[model samples]
Target: MSAVDVYLADQRAAIPGPSWTRRDLLREAGDHLEDATDAYTAAGYTPTEAEALALRDFGSVDDIAPGFRDTVAIGAARRTAVLLVLVMLPQAFLWDGGIELGASAHSAAPDSGLFHVLDIIIGYVGTAGAIGALVALAVTAIGQRWLRIGRRTARLTAAWSLATAMIVPIIGFTMLTLTGGLTVLLALSALAFMAAPFALVALSAQRTLAAC
Candidate 1:
């Protein structure tokens, strides 16, 4: 490969992004390198010597790529966080004892000791998972360095938190449905709502991981 081609390839190896994104970034980098090489060649240097000097002045891949990669990662994390908030906020209003079974809201069966116990258990589990997931998203939005967290550790922690955030609500609501407090229509609606967060987060995670 030509020196410019080789240099661009090395840069591509260091950077992590979608194909189009990487192409755009590398094109800008190649333009700078070409401009530097042309300037050196006009000063009487051989093509090879000019290319070498241009690369030397351009900075190493290790020196530049991490910052760019981290920027991309942080942007993805923010988008994911925004999505989670959008999905969860409306659902929070539904978590009250009064569930909508049809056009109107209906309270759960009164004086059911089993329902009370289930509500208490589900409340604790769901709250813990929800809070953990929010904290993880907040940390990711700010970046790992803010809390001295490593990249791998951050990804793993976020993945786990996201999974729990999705699963807990589904479990809690599904159990409520099993108690026969709602009609089939409402139970299905609840299931659909609970599953959305998990599905969306999984897809977001896949995209983020592929970029990384």
Candidate 2:
């Protein structure tokens, strides 16, 4: 391959993040390099010389990769934030269903204080988590455009997402177990409907943290 091609390959190897963002960065860089090469050739430089000049003008991968990495990291963070919001937004309804089921179960039980306490805790924690997810979304989206938000904010957001993802499932399963209605089918269904999406958010958030 040509020197410019080698440089791009090296850049691709150096950066790590979301595939789409990485592809976009490489595509735009390649387009710019092509344009620069063409301009140098029009000035009567040889093909090899034009390629060299274009590569030099484009700057070394080491020099450019940090900025590109930052962009990719931010993109990953935004995705995590969006996922968190999507997952959390529907949680109220899910919690309500769980609460109703728990209420019926608790009504027939001899002692119901633990279920009541767990129910209240879930409601408060879920609301707080939802609000936090919204704030993260806003910071990564709107704040990113208008403010100076960057990796620190992204890291914080990722941490918040991971924490919420972990906390929600633990409390949910505890409540489910306490209700004494937990069955294999119900457990599997909860894992599929509730834990799966939360697991996705957690994975995305973890990736975002690593990228940042």
Best by TM-score: 2
TM-scores for all candidates? 0.64, 0.87
lDDT on C-alpha atoms for all candidate structures: 0.65, 0.82
Least lDDT summed over 10 consecutive residues: which range in candidate 2? Answer: 101-110
Segments in model 2 whose C-alpha atoms lie over 4 Å from true places: 97-114
Q: After superposition, how far is residue 62 of candidate 2 from its true place, in Å?
A: 2.4
lDDT of 1 by residue, 1-212 (tens): 97889878987887665455567777888999999999999999999999999988988788868765655555555555556656655554666524544334343544667667766776676666556557657777665666754345436544654675556666666566656667666667766776666577657655555555
The 10-residue segment of model 1 with minimum total lDDT is 97-106
lDDT of 2 by residue, 1-212 (tens): 98888988999998887678889999999999999999999999998999999999889988999888888887888888889889888777654655444354442332578877877887787888888888887877777678877677778888988998988888888878876777676677678767999999999998888777
